[model samples]
Target: MPSLREDGAHLGSAQEPAARRGQLRLAALQEKVMLRFLIKKGTRMGLLILFAFMGFLHASIPDSGADDMEDISRFMENAGRIGRNIEIPENLHKAQGQKEAGKLLEYYQSEAFKRKYEAEIERLKGTVFKDTIDSYYGDSNGAEKDSVKGGTLPGNERIYLFISSSVPIGTLRNYARDLDRLGDPNVFMVLQGFVGGMKRVKPTMDFVRKIITEDADCDIQKNKCSAYKVKVKIDPLLFRKYGITRVPAAVYVPDVRIMDVTLSEGMEGNAKTGDHYVLHGDASLAYMLETLRRPSGRRSIDLLIEALKGGIYHEVNKR
Candidate 1:
């Protein structure tokens, strides 16, 4: 043996290199196994997250059929409410008859209407004898003469009938008949149309003339019946002043103090300087007659007289 110590040292060095190689191989094998285990765990977590997302999406979705039906039901309920709100009255004619009656009662009860009537009466009473004709009729000598002759009576007043050309011919005829039956000569009729256009005037005047002069037996050429004289004029200003918004309305202006004296001692006069009892709509002849007869602090008189008026009736056919 060359040297026992030297031999041992050489063997130890050789064994140390082999041990190092074995340690490197074992470390690489452990790294691969750890990587595989980490990848498998990550994949399982990703799959669980994906399933949870799918469940959330499913829960958020509404049932399309059920939602649509609910929306339809809401719409139908709203429509039914609208239909009930706009329901029509069954008795239209009956409603029409009561329309003015309610209004008249309200007006009678209104303090404002009473104050207005009283104020107007005071103003008019101050100038009762001043010959204050309405400025609507021109202040010419001829107009003044006409006003004195036909426009007014000594203690009587006029009935201003505000009518539109659009009113039915039958309705006009009925009004004329109702007025004729009243037959108060002092109550002059003033037919006023709201329209200002010249084109509309002739037709309206023509209609009024026809209705006034119409008789069963007489032709237009030979018709000699003396009908109630109606002063037909178009005055929008007058209509606005009187607060006449509707057609077929009658404004009955009573003499100052006459209405108050007749109805009650303390009752205010209803007639203003330009104000009148406004009859809003068409009423039956009997209804009008009875209503006129009521002591509403206004002149209650028949407008039509038996004596035939000579001037306009003769000239209507000529026109």
Candidate 2:
């Protein structure tokens, strides 16, 4: 009876504190939700920026010059490997029997390698020789023995042949076709092992000599093709300049130009301390063909410059 109203007022005041606590809890929960949302948005934004940068970087790369050089190098390496592995001659020894024979068969049957090899070799024999040989191979600027005749390249382009006398009949037949196709007057060939290997039959030598000397001009309609015997002695200076330390090396000289390394470039020479096996006619005629036909802007004298520089050095890639 003394405080019924007072009691009611105290109850109302108690309810106020409880209400305040509820409001505070609600505020904290809202803040947590907002923070989580912000973090998720930030993560998405960062990912978007990373992807944009990657896309921009992916759209820029060139197509010529250095890339072409790299392609050329790869091409040469592939050709050399293929030629070395296949095209077996009579002297090729497969003493390991079935194992070696199977390996040889695998290589021989690889159409991809064979096609590439054939194309490159044919190109060397055709284009490079056609472009340069007539100027230097003959006694007097590509003249025939009886007439003071000038020469022209077959196909009216560069024609060069990188061949070993020991090549198989199939390879020779393929080569013959290419020679037949040249229609220019100045085509020429560099006989890689012309002077030093085991001698061939007189008939074979006479036939090859005659083909290169007379038939090349008659069949191809040009006096440009010619052949020269690569000398036997491995000139140390020349070998050093070209970095050709391997034996049985051949260097095609169209206009006397070589395309390998040069002495001034600090290139090492082709000499082994105690072995003479590398000094004979076992020269890499195919590589020499590739070297002689190397692309150049200069004329005949450029060949001499290349030869002096040691054009045989880069014939094959490093083992």
The candidate that wins on lDDT is: 1
Q: Per-residue lDDT for 1-319 in model 2, tens only?
A: 2222421222233446887757755766677788899999999999999999988777664546798899999999999999888865665455567677677446534676446534543444455446433322222321322121222321122233334445553444434433333222223333433234323223434445443442344433334554432111112343444344443343322332222222111123321121111112332333333444454332542433344234334323332
Please, what are the lDDT tens digits per residue for candidate 1 over residues 64-156? 798899999999999999988996778878977799768754654577655653454344324421222122122322442343244323444
Each prediction's number of clashing residue pairs: 4, 40
Error of 1 at 229 (Å): 3.0
| Runs of candidate 2 exceeding 4 Å displacement | 1-150, 153-160, 190-201, 205-294, 298-319
lDDT of each: 0.50, 0.40
